[model samples]
Target: MTRLFTVPLAGAFALLLAAAGCGGSSTHDSTGDASVTIRIPDPGNEGLLALGKKDGSLAKALAVVHAKVAWTGSSGPFAPAAQELGADKLDVAQGSITSAIAALAQHPGFKLFAQIAPNKTGEGILVRKGSPIASVRDLAGRKVAVNKGGTAEYLLLKALASAGVPAGRVTRVYLNPAQTAPVFNSGQVDAWAVWSTYSIPEIASTGARFVATGGQIGSQNYSVWAVRNGFADAHPAVVQAFSRYLHDAGVRQAQNPASYVNVFTDAGPQAVSGTARRLTIQDLAQTAAPDGIRPSNVTDFDAVARFFAEQKITPTAVNVRPYVLSLTGSGS
Candidate 1:
């Protein structure tokens, strides 16, 4: 079995301290240890982090820097994980570009260091098989399930705008990730705005139809890895090592997609098929870039912030540069 540790989001802070060897010490100094805590959403499907954990590759890679990892499971959306990173309870966390931007607006202490491959194919607006909602424009006055304040909400807004639909025309039903499929299937919501892991499975099992995809709206949903500013400053080497590890993993998965897909099915629930897993992994690998955040990424993030502000999703526009860290020469 994989040696990754799983902790509930509520008790993550206390476990973070214990993982860092700060059990009895009052001093909050994290400079002396090479240990780090990373929080990943529960690997319900085969994400990169989940694949790495299942194969022992993630743990082995971290050991290269003599860094111990305390893996924590985030039960809900990326917002809570961002909160944990801001409170200094987590060294690193994974989130979407939209969520990361929103988090940075509130807590500039978090810096995006790297991004996973983009998977636009997995993101779309899903409707029941025979639902009358045939297109994004048809969503007016209908209820749509979105994980409010998350990638889903952003995608939905962008998709609607692309279809010439105003944001206020639809009823935005906020639901947790786990609640989306059931609610949509039960007719509680007219449609669901979701990405691959959730959207893919539901489409496969329930014969749902896609009204619009992220690709159709030119929305590139990139899953990103961000670290607390203080943590990155204190442990630059560890960050570099982890970045390389992730990049390498992306390459490996790209080369042998079947292997990673098998790992996911063998290690946990077989919710996704080998074909879907392979396509998702391929999309991630094809879009994987080097260690540092690119200028285009920053520009896109700023654009997302502006969109959020214009839609009243965010209270204000955020400047993304302040929360970006440069790992150019860090040997990543």
Candidate 2:
């Protein structure tokens, strides 16, 4: 049982727990609630977060620290979540290291605490069946779809560089995850660069084929989690507890992806089934040594930061070292 108490005069209380549905950015704020609600971002339709939320595992995990979660789900891109974090609307959210680095370059309101590891599969370039393009090397002078500044764009750029194909030669069609499907399915773009959530489903349904994966492109990008600076300062234990829970769950999900079928946040239970589900399970199981949440990798963070800056995506390269914090110790 959670011991409820009341403070007649708490110094500062900014309660911002929002139902804020997915597919659009919506926020709700209040300061009257006695308990603190840690706001988190997700895609809403599918993810481990949604699964845990649906099955009550997440709530149970947070109850140990006397914290609850206010979920914000959106479907467009990962960059907007940074604005939400800066606005004090989100306490923690997940995105590639590049996204975090770019956000830190401009806002400096969030810090990278932990990361999900072995992000080698599910994100890469996909081409429609019977297409003339054979590989990344063949993408020269082709129209490729990518989410600007998102991991997909980064991967496509890296892959093109690896294949000795100039990005200028390949026209990049910038599209969010939502808009690219129709255009790609209709062959408006020669290929689509995307993450697992879209790539897996797209391939399963439309027979889209991956020309190269992030791993194949030698990408060091990671699925990283970040927390608002003030929120981490005030509630380190909650963040730590949540990280521990995720570490355990990540291990489980990697080992037995089928067990977490109910964690679908979008399609209820049946959203992920058949080949897509199989691919999802196979993708996780393929990670022989899953690196669950651990201390921040400063080198990797700095590298990604510089990569973004060099690509003209950010104003300048952020060291990203100061933003790296140790989960087990005082904020680093």
Candidate 3:
């Protein structure tokens, strides 16, 4: 599987590509007429890149010359993208570095390209305000809600163990963040492990308090980028171009905070409206950059991988070096 990281910087290039649509073949021209579509996760939090796209930064540079930009987000698209490279389905897939690893474990077609910005914040444990549960220790013997088949669940498992609670001591009740909230408030679940964007605001509205955050666990747990290996090898130039632009976008997000949030607010859903999403995004953007956005080369990934292995989330730990595509051949 391919994994990469990015930051927002410019526009105009993206705008020109957006105008070209998806009918043409993936041919390159001096004026940049090639078409490339990328899938992103949580498009709502993807403000900086979306802004670059809307402003035509990537399109103008790639469009009509050798590249076109189509932004798609879907979990099911990974396998299809791998099988249909010539059909022009996808060039890049956006997701957490771990998710990319999992994808590779399932389908070893994608390759790691480059590093995107570290999704530094946006996680927290929630409990209704004035509830007797004030900290992670209190979760003992009480039921805790989590999305069963999610990274958040792993995060919570680790966080709880690190917080001095036995993993088996706390009951893990599977539930989506949305479902867990009401049940938590109603006493169906004692506490809920959730991302900050939804959980923080929901807690504030319901007078809840936070018990922990993902950031407390480490940096490699956030989002990253990936591309199909065959596609990256066939089109090195395009991969490099996209990687540079994404890196620049990460720089822009770091340099300007609120502006990035505004970009997402314009196109994102109501759930992230006003201050909640902005705060959450700002929080998540601080986790620190990954070496090409994959865990195979990082220490944090080791801890995370061990946690997953112990949890039996995967049959074995992943070796990220052979899978990742790095400019230097050595990781950051």
Q: Against the true structure, what is every candidate's RMSD? A: 8.1, 8.5, 7.6
The TM-scores of all predictions, comma-separated, are 0.81, 0.82, 0.72
Model 1: residues >4 Å from true position, as ranges? Answer: 1-45, 74-76, 262-291, 329-332
Task: Indicate the worst ten consecutive residues by lDDT in candidate 2.
Answer: 1-10
Off-target runs (Cα >4 Å) in candidate 3 are 1-46, 73-89, 116-121, 177-180, 218-220, 264-274, 277-281, 284-297, 329-332
Give the per-residue lDDT of model 2 (tens digit) for 161-267.
Answer: 78988778898998878778999998899999888778888988878888888888888788777878788666654665576667666666666776665355325
TM-score ranking from best to worst?
2, 1, 3
The predicted structure with the larger TM-score, 1 or 3, is 1
Q: Pick the candidate with the highest TM-score.
A: 2
RMSD of 2: 8.5
Name the TM-score of candidate 2: 0.82
How are the candidates ranked when ordered by lDDT, highest leading?
Answer: 1, 2, 3
| Two-way TM-score contest, 2 vs 3, winner | 2
Candidate 3 displacement at residue 17 in angstroms: 22
